[model samples]
Target: MAFDVSVIIPVYQRQELAVSALRSVLEQKGVTFEVIVVDDGSPDPFVLPADLADNDRIRLLRQPNAGAAAARNTGVRATSADWIAFLDSDDLWLPGKLAGQLAFARDGLLKGWPHLTAVMCGFTQIDLPSGSRRHRIPVESWNAAELAAGCWFGPGSTALIPRNAFEQAGLFDETLMRLEDLDWFMRVGLLGGGVATWPELAVTVRVGGRPSVKMLDDAVGRMRAKWLEGGRVDGDTRRNLAAYLALEQASARRHAGRWLGFLGCMTRSLLLRPRLRVPLRRWWTEDPAAAPQ
Candidate 1:
């Protein structure tokens, strides 16, 4: 039977987590799909659990140590499905993830929500080791503007999209090495295609080493570099993208003790969105006399 969606997982050293993610996909309730695992050159020679490896729906594609973007891109190219879902190796889905997303897509189709170009679902943040302490984002409508303006995304793992849309948007930037999701999503947004999010938590996004603060900074820097590398812009998008990149830079700079840099960023933000100038004006008030705890 042909699958409705292919869940692609890019695996590195986290074999156990990858296996668990695959199991979660396999356990997806009421959904007919296949799990495609891209072993992104994991140094560890951990093999898939034999008991589950033989399953027709779970296939592994071995590749050299390409970045995660390359791995996922290869997986997308190899899968045999019109729709594709992305899952990070370390994240796990709720019991009904695929079913929920597919159902959402079907409803959108019935209601004529275009081809349902993209679908995003919410996620629960989990602390590792014990995997305890869960916090979910408050349910809210997925705002395209907010996503474009740069807000926290639980994970790229949440996206379920039409294969054709991805074809149009092109694959994740292999050179990105990180922050590829936001970069890809931003490019996808530029295409003027619609993106939707389910708002309901459908996956447990593990936040430990992979999604670290440093990783975020690195990704943002890379994204900014790429965003500008596209050359001169002739629209509101360039204005907004520059401002957003500055905001990201300012925040990073503030954390790095570059007060002047931070101010410069705040200036850009205010410049881009004049209305925000009045509200975010006092972010520089520093506390001078705090004792070491």
Candidate 2:
């Protein structure tokens, strides 16, 4: 069957989580879609759940362990549909996610809006270990300038992008181990049409994993060098990106229980951009006296 959308799921080692993710995709109603599960050379090699093993709508591909970005690009190349949606092996799509995004994209195309590249929706992030949930809604507009400052498009799972956008913006940067979505979206935003976002929650992201400090540092350094010091972006964009990177490092340090490092990053973040006082205070302390004033 010619599918309306192709769902790309990149899996690493979590076989059980991959099964659940695929089930959630199959549960999506009002849309005809195909599921492509790319196994990124898991040590054990992923096998589909028995029930879905013979399902014709799903295809499983295996490749040497490339990052999620490469896996997604492979899936896109194999897709039979014009629209593509990404679902991490650990994430699940909420009901109406595919259908609603499709409708929104079609409407934008009908209206001939040049800035409509992809339709994104809000999502609920669940910290699996803590069982804490946070509902994140996308802002009304997400242009290049806004994306460079921060990643407001939620996660890769929350976007429904057309195939052409990938062709024009280029596929995800395989070199980026983290923040590949942010990097790719930045390019898409530069295409004159920024991403279209809605407030409706559409995906459930299971979080809890933390990257090593060294890994985070490396990623941040790459981002800063590319977007900030490379003379590729505007002055405001550089400042915003620098501030965002500092805050991100601060958050990572806080999560890793590195209080001193956290404080330093927070201070740098504030010094780079005083407008970040609200976030600085929130990250520092809720108490008026304790928080940065």
Candidate 3:
């Protein structure tokens, strides 16, 4: 039977979490979907649970240890559905996530909004160890210009995109170990594809240790070269991206329990943007261990 959506899961070393993520997909109702699990050469080879091994709706593919971008590209090639959704091995989907997003997309199509290449929903970030829920972002729409300025939502788990999006925007840049989502989304926005949101939380993203500050700086530098060179992005967009990167670095430092680093990043973020300076200044006064509400 034809499927409404193809859920591609890219797994690296996390086997247990991969199984749990698959279970969440299996629990999804009100949608016809197929699951493709691409194992990026985990040290301990991924095997389906005994019960799931006999299930025909799920397919497992194996490849050498390429990064998540390559694995997702491989999965996209094998997908038969017109719409595609991606879920990392460590994240999860809430109940009816697919059905609701699919309905929203259909509505957009009926309203002649073919430029709606992707539909994203809100997601909550849950910090590890403490497992405390951080701030919840409600879904909101963004035009091409707004998206071109900066990333606004979680794309890996919460995005339901048409297969053609990859064709037009191009696949995820395998070279980017970070910020591939932002890069791809910006390309989509440039191609006249506007992003819409479902206006509800539909995914849970587990936050863990982040890459080092040096690594993040390197990634941001690459982005600056790619987008800001030769006046591709205007001055406002450049500052917007700078402020966004600083805030992201601050959040990473906060998650890693580096107070001085967090403060430094926050200072740069607030200085560059200044719109949210007062509220964020108050946020810094709170306990560092406490997750943002």
Candidate 4:
């Protein structure tokens, strides 16, 4: 039987959460869907969940520890469906996620929205200790320009996109450890696809402290490079990226007590990033103007 959707899940070291994610997928209603679990070289031996063990619809593939992007790409390749959705191993979905989103996509197809390439709705943010709390993005819709100027994937779990979009926009850039989804979203935005949102419940985004945060300068520098390489970024986008980068770097430097370095970053970011100009101006207006120059 042809499935309505294929849900791709990428897992790393979190096996328990992954099993729970599989259960959530099993609970989804009104859609015949397949689950593809690509384990990103977990160190522990994975015991396939009980519900998945006997089922042909559940496929588990093992690959060496590449990053999450590569793991997700592997999962997407094995799944057979027109519409592809993703839920991270640590994240999950509310029941009926597939049904509602699939219906929304099908209706758009017939309603002169042939260009619809991706549909993402709201999602819950699951706190590791607290269990779960629903979290949603403020925007209900996006166009190529809006998404390009700002980054919004609506969280990877909430996005359901056509298989064809990946074929055109290309797979996620594997080089980026951080902000890979943001990069992919920008590429989709550049390809001129209709991006519509349901503004309703979609998936649960699980947040936990696994990998410790990196140094601010290193993270921002990498993200800036990734965002630039992925899109047809205009002057405005460049400006935003630059400003963000500068602010991040300056703040990091300031915290480290490198006042001279902080001033340089603040000036560069504030100068290039007009969006931050007013706020930063007020911040530095009282201080020594000598630092920025």
On TM-score, the candidate that comes out on top is: 2
Clashes of each: 0, 1, 0, 0
Error of 2 at 208 (Å): 1.0
Worst 10 residues of 3 by lDDT: 278-287
Clashes (candidate 4): 0
lDDT per residue, candidate 2, 57-154, as tens digits?
99999999988889998898899898998999999988888888898888887877564378878777888888877776665444566666667556
Task: Kindly state the number of residue pairs that clash in model 3.
Answer: 0
lDDT computed for candidate 4: 0.71
TM-score of 3: 0.86
lDDT of each: 0.71, 0.80, 0.79, 0.71
Worst 10 residues of 4 by lDDT: 283-292
Worst 10 residues of 1 by lDDT: 284-293
| Higher-TM-score candidate of 1 and 2 | 2
lDDT of 1 by residue, 101-211 (tens): 888877776876646257777666676756674544322223334334553444778888888877787888887665576566666666665566565668888867434
Instruction: Output the TM-score of candidate 2.
Output: 0.90
Q: For candidate 4, what is the TM-score?
A: 0.78
Q: lDDT tens digits, residues 1-293, model 3? A: 89999999999889899999999999999999999999998889899999999898999999999788889999999999989999999999989999999998989878876564688777777879787875444334344445644455554898899999898888988777778787888778767786776766778899776787666777777777887664676655566666777787887678778899999988987887787542322311222344557
Q: Which parts of model 4 have CA positions greater than 4 angstroms off?
A: 114-116, 127-134, 138-142, 210-232, 244-293
lDDT of 2 at 255: 86
Model 2: residue 45 alpha-carbon error in angstroms: 0.9
